[model samples]
Target: MSRVRTLEEIPLRKFHWQMFFYTGGGAFIDGYIIGIIAVALAVLQPQFDMSLTLVGMIAMATYVGMFFGGIIGGYLTDIIGRKTMFLLDLGLFVLASIPQFFVTDPAQLIIWRFILGFAVGADNPISATYMAEFAPSKQRGVLLGGLIALWYVGYGASYLVGYWLLALGDDSWRWMLTSSAIPAIILLFARLKMPESPLWLASKGKVKEANAIIQKIFGKGVILSESFEYKEKTSFMDIFKNGYGKWTLFIALFWTLQVAPAFAIATYIPQVLGEFGFADGNMEYLGSAIMSLFYLVGLLPAIYLVDKIGRRPVLIWPFLVSSVVLVVLGITSSWQMSFALTITLFVIYGIFNTSMNIHQWIYPNELFPTKIRGTAVGFGTGVSRIGASLSTFLFPLILSKYGLEVTMYCCAALFFVGFLISFMMAPETRNMTLAETSTLNKPSIKFSSKPSPKRETV
Candidate 1:
């Protein structure tokens, strides 16, 4: 009998790309749902007569919901399994989005937005893990990087939809919100036809099932002889029991710092443009439209370079460069200079920020064992959502109190913190196996004495 080959031995080709698309569509749904809300707020503020503070509150509500959803979803992902949580969360997003069209009050809109955010929060960990688990090692970076690119595509699409709907001027915020439902539906159908993660199956001690799935992907030669032995089922305490406590803390802090600047810029781009002397009417929308194009362009190379250059460089350099650009924008008084500076900063920020965002999904999933992957991801992401929520609330206050210049300076400061954190602590996981990556910084226990050899054989 011939021995079976491992999955890595299989050729990389269209099959992997097909899988990337199916899984990536779920991410697109996630991005579309979240990104569209920023644009819709511009239109809805006028229609509903909302105060700037109230609008910020509504945006924060979504992040608040995301905080809880990420925690719950991450916990459930390990408990009920990834596929189950993925489907259920998709349903929640679809259901939450449909109600926005019927909202009669700002308060009601805030409630529904929070609910939608809770459901959408599950996407980061689940989709990233799903893609990583299924991808061949050689292509993991590109596949995950491309997944991030697709997410930005969704972001760009949201802006395009918002711009077009607002132009209709027929009270079209409903159309803007409803547009999200289409992607959600498409993802639901696409996911139905996809297979479960074989790595997850093997980790759960279902070797035969895992092997069968692997065979389908890699042909019949892959072996199933390895045991599915794992440490006892993990709990929240496990992150601390091992030496992972420090790592987890740093990751959570890193994510918090990351979201602060990114969300601050993203949530207030239109308002920021108005400050730069762009007309409050169509010109605000036009600036956003142009910025969105730059965003998409920045996202592509970031994704392409993420795996090729390794995670650390891709993550750190972009943030550092963007920080300098943001500082320049904050200090410049010339409207034209500030506008060009803001666009340049936004483009660089989008690229690095998108790269960091993609890795946020990938690294957490890869950092822990399958038993604890969901929990760690949820905790880290949930904490980050808290940061995002705070930033959303604070941005408007900063704009009102100190003006856009000070607010942007604050954003630059946040990015500087993130840059330092990434530079100091983040691990290089590119092309490494899950087992290899999980052991970083773990302590080795040395026995006080070596055990004597058994002498009973005679």
Candidate 2:
């Protein structure tokens, strides 16, 4: 009799690609939801007669919702199962998205945007967990990174949509905000066929159910690996105990430092461009659209290098290069700021900063065990959004009061601090199995708890 193949040993198949497309669809919509609003807010500010503070509140509200959604949705994902939460969140996205077309006041708009953001937040950890649990260890980086790449694609697409729609007269922002519903509805229906994660199922001791899924999807030749037998009681607190506390802290820190500036800058790139010289509204929106391409270029190299050279190098080196770029831009903010020089610096920063951002999806999922992966990811997402929310809210206030030089300097400092922390703490998980890379195998690694001899596998 032939030995049954493990999920790790199987070659990439049609199922994997289809799964990524279906699972990754949420990310595309997430990109559109956030990205469209960057330009939409430009119109919203003047039309709504919003104060700078009110504009900031409207901008910050989605992330505030993200903060709550990540925590609540993440816990529920682990408890109720990835498949259930997967469809439900997108439904929320649809319901929240349609109301944007009808809001009569700033408060009503903020409420709808917050609800849309909640859906996006819940989908973040859920999609990452689903992809990671099913992906071959060798290709996990690309699969996870591709999910983020889709986010940029969605973001970039939104810019294109917003740029064109800006020509549609004063009410264009409504259409831009409501457009997210199209993708959200499509993904909700598409994902209904996706199976529950086999690894998650195996971890729950549903071996028969898991094996049926394995054979059904991966073929009759594949079976549950021996590693799946290990089982233990899981708690929400597990992510904070057993040496996980340090990882939890590291993920939250790096995630926050990376996103706070990125989100702030992306959210207000038009205004930043205005300061630099592209003061025309059309020109500013056009420039922001072009900047999206630079980010996509940066992500391509990272997807290749992540599994090639290892995670530590991919995470560590980009932080250094991106930080240096920001420092240069900050120092030059006092100069005349020629278009060529300004665009060059912005392009370089966008590329490298976006490159490093891929790890936000990769790290938290890799660092924790299957049992607590959702909770850990949720915690990281929620904490990072707190920073993002504050930065988005405060960015305009600071820009108005302190000028671009001060704002650039502050962001530079944050990126440099991130470089230092990542250098000291980033772990290498290049070729290791999920069970091996997580706390399940390495007990002696400082603050971690000892793993039991029992193991779980898919």
What's the lDDT for all of these models?
Answer: 0.74, 0.85
The segments of candidate 1 whose C-alpha lies over 4 angstroms from its true place after superposition are 1-3, 223-232, 333-342, 443-458
Query: Which digits, one per residue and each the tens of the lDDT, describe model 1 over residues 295-388?
Result: 6676666667766777788778767876777887787735565456656656766766666766676677667777778777888878899999
**Backbone clashes under 3 angstroms, per model:** 0, 8
Model 2 gets an lDDT of 0.85
Per-prediction TM-score? 0.91, 0.95
The list of candidate 2 runs beyond 4 A from truth reads 229-231, 444-458
Model 1 residue 157 distance off true place after TM-score fit, in angstroms: 0.4
Best candidate, TM-score-wise?
2
Worst lDDT run of 10 residues, candidate 1, spans: 449-458
